[model samples]
Target: MLPEAKPGPARRLVDAIRYGNSVVLTLLAMLCALLVGAIMIVIADPPTRSAMGYFFSSPWDTFTRGWHAISAGYVALFEGSVFNPDSLYSNGHTPIFGPISNTLLNAAPLILGGLAVGVAFRAGLFNIGVQGQLIMGAICAGYVGFAFRLPPLLHLLAALLAGVIGGAVWGGIAGWLKARTGAHEVISTIMMNYLALGLLNYLLGISGFQAPGSNQAISRSVHGTARLPHLLGPNLSLHLGIVIALLAALGCWWLLTRSTLGFSLRAVGANPSAARTAGMKIERSYVVVMLISGGLAGLVGCSQILGTNHALTGDIDAGFGFDAITVALLGQASPRGTIFAGLLFGAFRAGGVVMVANTGIPADVVLVIEAVIVLFLAAPALIRAIFRLRESRGGGVGVGQLAKGWNA
Candidate 1:
């Protein structure tokens, strides 16, 4: 009888297992960064110095007690951010939904903004104006949400539509500059971002447009009818905007993969001259994609106002528009990737507080750990070295290579 064939470890493992390994590897990098950070803390002072002592006590006690405390705290952060926790901190029934809801709420806008950045990336456009577009969209949606007199559902829809219009118009101007004058989108978008912010503030604070009897510069409260409904009772904070964001992602997936318009977009992004030679509307593609991007960014503002914040204020967006850039990059410009990345970032934000509150670890350390993760994520080289990924720089796509066409 023929000898039985021997199998290597790679062949023995299932494809699902291999795929799961990749995800684990990424998480491992995050942990690795934390480990490195801990080592630095230990070497710098050994729990005796100002910074180190602030977290724990003496060095001898640190190894036995401090080390475990920090590790457990980080783990708690992970648990609190992603999974359901039925246990209560106090006597009250623990709302397992807290982290999950916050994750979705924080991610809702990231999804839309991620879509915006992802589309521009695909078209070789380095569109950085999502921040400005986001601000414009929020203020636009905010204005309509409070200023209108339509039925509730209609009012909400109208507010969202206004945001789309506002963002599209803003983005369209940049696209026009690009197509007509050959201005680089990176520069134009940067300028436009500032313009959007200034314009938004002006519109909201203007006497005629400002809320009555309110000296402070802010929009009026949204009509009860215009506000998004929470599936749970009013006590809960989640809303229908999450549903809208998901639908938008599905819609974008369809548009990019299946539609004729998508094909044209890809063609133009790949080669504008070639597209022109083949009779594709190159200028129109540039204009439309930026508008779509703007609209998507605007939707983020709408979701924030209509779903959660319930009104427009200067504080809206809270740098989320800027944060969405990291989200888009980390997600590799994929819709599902964006969703997951958004959750990861949101979880870090949610859990960092608790980790600090429960343990004596400084919250800023948690923030540093998070920042390091994204830094490493954006540079696959850092992750590759840490985990020894065999793939060479040219072997396959790298994380830094996600966005294309902007230099053109």
Candidate 2:
């Protein structure tokens, strides 16, 4: 028998490249965003522009000064979001885990919000009203947290359940409209957001929800019994919400990959007409998927109110809903990917403040980075063309696929 031929170094290199293609593309996109941000920084700074005037005459000086400014900004971002080695010895009172804790706290809601969008994407639904759903959830959860008197653990559970139910009902309305009246979810969801904002404004004026002796639009604080316990200590902001977010991510993964209903949802998303021909209940799937998606979104409110904020305010939603759409796309609509994407975005959010305070870089720069990332992700073909990369074995999903799913 002839000996089996071993794979050569070139063949192994090709396989590795193919296997990590998506990750490589994503990293490259991030690099492009950073480069753009650096250019913006230079343009915004008068000193940097003056130094660049002598690019050819004094190349070393120009390069060193420009690089120094860019590095300082990124270093501040890193220290604020991840860790600052200087903090270890510079301040005896500084908590070693403080920065990481804040990052986790910020990421918790993003994970839940991203899952909401991801779940809807899997079912051919566009749940743009996640903002409204989140608001409703916070209202319901906040009411339960302050009004009800119960055992500690049970009270917390009750408040969370109330939030979930509120979000489900809100989402179900859009699904029902889509199924019965042929209303597009996008339009219905947008309308619902306006309605929710109006309702929130009205409700805040009521004595029942408003804080005692306060003219502000904030609701009463949640009771201690209903509050999510801190995983770290009172000094740190990190709470049990991170644990819940991780569990929810795992649940979403199981639902999408293992459950029969998930299969039905995917089939409908791929082709509603074919799904209907196969005897699958497309309309019901829409309602079910939206309900679940909204419930997931509602958890963002829980994280904010019960875990972090502990009070309901007009701005409680914190843009998590819209940011989630980008997170979902960056994650490619996968639960695991959503978690990583959420963390990355969370880091940017946490770091932006430090970058601004220490390096004088505007916080809006982070927003620009996020927008650029979305631009690149939305056009994978452009990235491939620029990089001159060969197509991977499974190829890639694009905005076209997402659009087709919506139509289906």
| Tens digit per residue, CA lDDT, model 2, 147-169 | 99999999999999999988888
RMSD of each: 4.6, 2.5
Candidate 1, residue 361: lDDT: 62
- Tens digits of per-residue lDDT, candidate 1, 366-387, equal 5566667677766655666665
Total clashing pairs for each candidate: 4, 0
The TM-score measured for candidate 1 stands at: 0.84
Give TM-scores for every candidate, taking all chains together and pairing residue i with residue i. Answer: 0.84, 0.94
**Alpha-carbon error at 220 in model 2, in Å?**
0.9
Off by over 4 Å in 1: 1-25, 33-59, 83-93, 356-363, 392-394, 398-400, 403-408
